[model samples]
Target: MRFQTITTDILVIGGGLAALKATHSASESGMEVLVVSKGTICSGSSFYPLMEALGCQAPTEDPEDNIRLLEEIRESSFQMHDEELTKIYIDEIRDRVAELPAMGIPYRKMQGGRIPCFAKRARDIFIWEDWNAIRNKSYALLKAKDNVRLMEHCTVIDTILHDDHIAGALCIDRQGSLFVISCRSMILATGGFGDLFEHNLNPSDVCGHGHILALDAGAKLVNMEFIQFIPGFMTPRYKVLFSEQILGYCTQVNDAEGRDLLARYLPSSITSRQCLDERSKHGPYTSSDISRYFDIAMMKEINDTGCEKGFNLSYDPKLLEDKREFISIYVDWIRKEQHIDLLGTKHTIAPLAQASNGGIVIDVRCATGVNGLYAAGEVAGSLHGADRHGGNASGSCLVFGHRSGAYASQWAKSCDRQAINTSIARKALTERFEHHRPNRIDADELIKEIRHLMWYHANVVRNERDLVYAKDRIRQLYEDFNPATHMSNPKTIGMAVKADHAARLSMILLECMLLRKESRGPHYREDYPEKNDRSYARRLMVQSTADKDIEYRFT
Candidate 1:
């Protein structure tokens, strides 16, 4: 099939904070921007915001607020993050948030003060509960930009190369139309591979498109080893609802119902201000030493009391009696937040979802090793090194997305247009589609198996054996991926490529994680329980230097 073509000054792929910021910055700088979406604009991981989330705020009144905030995220990153990149995002975080309200994003506010970053708030800071509203507002703003052209419901199959530099991308519409969008520069704000895990909070659409695209384009990828496994948020009944309640309330539910069921992880000295210690790294309470802080006998008694109480404190309004504001919040959550009936019940959450800690290695300007191509958001591994800070994801995406967009636009303006050749697009996309020729393996079935494989091997707990098993399974999947019917169809081919892309991403990260013997933020190993700064202190990246199978080298 011949390619139908459209050209633009700058091409922004993936529609979220990163893509929106990039497109908007380029357009505001007087460059035409064509922004593409993998799905609806307001979907994916960023769609569900749990309260303020990020704590990137600083005021003259609070002398150490900014430092403290930076310290928080830095700690999460295990001090492995790029200092400049972290600082830049932190500096412009509020600027990004301020833009949201101006764009009509809904956020619960009080006396004109907006919600501050992070789930916790001490005093006069604006604490917001409405996050879906924020996402909608950002979407509205992006939709309103004149220079920005929004193309929803599209998937980029592959890049069309010109003299080895990226000239454009080939995409397929929902109705299976082959549309080639040519541009001098491309910005990939494609999110992360969190959907690789079955129980992740990130939406399923975020299946590591950015990593695969960059790999095919020969861009160097780094830190694929560190996939962040969030510690808190284990709900009993639901299939991993967010630990958002704990984020606001500083609560921790049962861990697979172990630890005597009532052994508290919190230290005896904990107050309202000190509650975060239960969840923090330096926190006195932990899974390894559960009995250290809690009296086992007391814990058993409390567990019995909690059981006799019939409803877990999480849902029971009685627990909130002493704190009416908290009661109101609980009432609102029970009434609005949780879909649970007002009838009190105990909810179970365990390591709710995985967050991506690292991916492709990009520089401060969001440029990867490949020229004429830039990656932002989760795809670009610049901000978070070992583990990501609480609110860094959205903030970094907004800040760097804007920077990458501006740079891409500026570069596109100077480069003279070479007629985009159609041969490259057809060949690249067709070969990709051909891999999925249908004989058997239903896309649905294969996808489910892959998810389970990742959940068992790659998510939260990891050891040498599991990681090895995961790598071998991924290899088998790659081999068995052949389809029998309509094998050469473009739509089928693209979907197959997506599966391959996600699988490859899992293998690459898992391989790197397996190689790293030390335990870090997201890449925890049961064998090496302690964080070993001695050997595995540096950042890790896996690049396909020569062959299809990746080779790892540190960055």
Candidate 2:
């Protein structure tokens, strides 16, 4: 019950590229900024640098190229993106990307010019070859700043609101100690909820707790149904993201039963070679193309066989022999970093949860509609809708990360820090951990259950029946959860809190998926099976009402 109170002008929550960029921008305002992360600073999906590297796309110097890039974004996202935000991204991305070099984070520059990835001709992307160097330099720069303070191994329990505005946050450190962080403004750059699934490429702590925090603060989350699933290794190296670039070279794919996986799933019109070629052009699974069958087959194999290790996939190195440029970079990086020879290895592949394109809705300025609160990066929604462009993930992090921090700082400077009441946070915490029930749910077990439930029912393919089952099961799990019984061990407290957050988020996400009732982007319903633009074109938004009920509406 004992807690310490800390006051700051701004509070930034997250540990990834977005959080670090926000911190850097906020520090410029000369305000007292406190960054709290569940993990170490510079950790999260961005640090992982999947595929070729952590790709960041920006507009080329040519004006026509920029226009084409904008068109490509709209086309690629299935016209589901916010126009205003998309324009802002295209216009400001170049400047934001330029800042990287000054921060000592060097990117690969090919001889000709920008390297385009993920099937976009107009789009030019820069890949960071050395993510560790970027992480170290980013940390060093932020640490050297006088007004910024970084707190690691700290989990934010909930957002504290006063008069329906951001006041502070309730947090707990790695130890059992509690801290009340009062700030004029708070930024949620806490990445995505990929960790909520049974299989994901995200770090252990990268659950969508930030989405729940934003909802609690009365912010609406948009496009919750659009989750990006990528092909990743299920064995040899579990959850290691398999590059889509190399997917084209996959000569054979067979399930444990020796059944040809792709051949079994592909439609009569599409050949295995054609599917692989189309699938290789993009990373995330999309209903927009025939390539979707690649991920669909993988998911189906896992679901049908209940094979935890997924299917065996073998690649032809001879296919890549013609493309030495790719071999030198991607193939070599895999060999050096992952300790895997892509050509020589026969690995198990499955549809792994990669990122969430939909999240807490933010405007052009990255404001989350709620005062004193903002969101950026993967945590912020409406920026990328349906299917996101390949490099836009890291690009949006920089563009909106700076926007959120700068705007939050500007807003913070205009107002005085409000006195935050800890009663609400305390009450919720007590309700969560105060129960003395002898029979209590295990947080770790609950999380595993939730992950399996999500992956099986809600991931890749969904129908009303499966989605409803997921929703009911999540509600049951929530009712059964009693964290107080496990309070004796402080380490488990964070896990317990995360489980609760994941359950709440999972319920909302399921509802959104169910409400859409149409196939669009990553949110494909097997029952619907087709995109219905007339009925379900608009983005779905979810928010928490005053009565503690979730409200959903089409925007």
Candidate 3:
């Protein structure tokens, strides 16, 4: 069957804040834009706001303070960030935050001038009305644009390249129909790889396809080992994230044993109060924090004992007695959302994979090494070195989204149109349908196994032995994958593609993890417990070879 072909000046693959900003910027720059979203606009991880001091770092008049704050952020990333890119982001974040109101985000301002946010010492966090309200408004803005065309329920399978430049992309729409999107420039804003892990806070659709596409197109990816995990709800449905602030107020109890788990792991010298206080500061588990043992204990409990039920987090009712108003306003929302009371109740939670601290390598312009390809938001790497700062992820999305759109639009305007080789796209589609049998592997089963395998071996904690086993198992699964039975179903096909990408990315992540022999930020290893800056301080870079071999280089 001959597939339909659509042409556009710039093709943006994603529908979150980054993609929306990129689309808006590209359209505003007088370039026709086409947005292809796996899900609806603002429906990815960008929609899920973090409770722990989430806000952007806006620029200040004091240059000294800016430098100090940048140093702090670099410290947060474990000193692995691209200095030039960090400087550009630090300089432009305030401007991006300023533009939010115009784009329909109703940021609540406090009494003392600027909008108040939750942060440590720094005060740049701002509260918006809600995710739904902002999403509706942003969707309206994108729909209202005459130059931008939005396609929902579409996934890009392969980026068509001609002579090292992007010619177009092959996509699968909702109805299992394949089509070729011919574009002069492409922007990838497809979020992170949180969904690759079994216990993750991100939506299921974020299966690391952006990294896969970029790698296949001969682009480089960096720091794939550093994924951040935080304490989040495990049972009664995975709806909301357990806030980092809760560590201070709650008691950690092993649900099955009904005993304090931290007491067993932490030294006996420290009292329970001291341990809790230390655990409070290490909510997201930073390597720089001495309290990271709390996180390690949580993981060990689950991993060693097969405690899949996770831990029971409870707070003394007496603690909330004086702060009833604050409890009603803040704590009441979690109860209402989850339909479970907080105080005196053991809310089970474990380390949930939050975000990928690293991703596809990009420059200050959000341009990948590949000429016509640009990446923004979590899809693009080098912004966060070891660990990401609190509010920088959201801010980075807006900042680089604008840059990606502007730069890609300018490239589209200047570059000559490249002719696409239809045979390449045809071959991809043909290979996709090569197997069609009931004896083939189930897409759902494949995805489930990959998710569990990743969480078991390649998740928060890792060792060299487990990583090698995981690599072999993942490679075997990929080699034996059977997408034949569900090839005709678009949804299944999407899952198959993501599963394939997940397998490939898992190998890359394992390799990077094995090479980086130190416990730095989120990438922790039990074998190499110490941070060895003299040897493994630099970032690990990986690129695809001509024969599809992944080659690694540390700089």
Clashes of each: 22, 1, 3
lDDT of 3 by residue, 144-186 (tens): 8888898898988888887889889988887878788889999
In Å, residue 101's CA in model 1 sits off its true spot by 3.2
Best by lDDT: 2
| Most accurate candidate by TM-score | 2
Question: Candidate 2: misplaced stretches above 4 Å?
Answer: 49-52, 110-119, 324-327, 421-428, 431-439, 484-492
Please give the lDDT score for candidate 1. 0.62
Candidate 2 per-residue C-alpha lDDT over 462-513 given as tens digits, one digit per residue, 9 for 90 to 100: 8999999989987787778876765556556677788878888999989999
Alpha-carbon RMSD to native, per candidate? 5.9, 2.2, 3.1
Q: How does model 2 score by TM-score?
A: 0.95
Candidate 2 has its poorest 10 consecutive residues by lDDT at 110-119
Q: Where is model 1 more than 4 Å wrong at Cα? A: 49-73, 106-140, 231-241, 244-277, 280-331, 341-343, 432-440, 483-487
Clashes by residue pair, model 3:
55-391, 77-386, 117-125
**How well does candidate 3 score on lDDT at residue 348?**
81
Query: How far off is residue 499 in model 2, in Å?
Result: 1.2
lDDT of each: 0.62, 0.83, 0.77
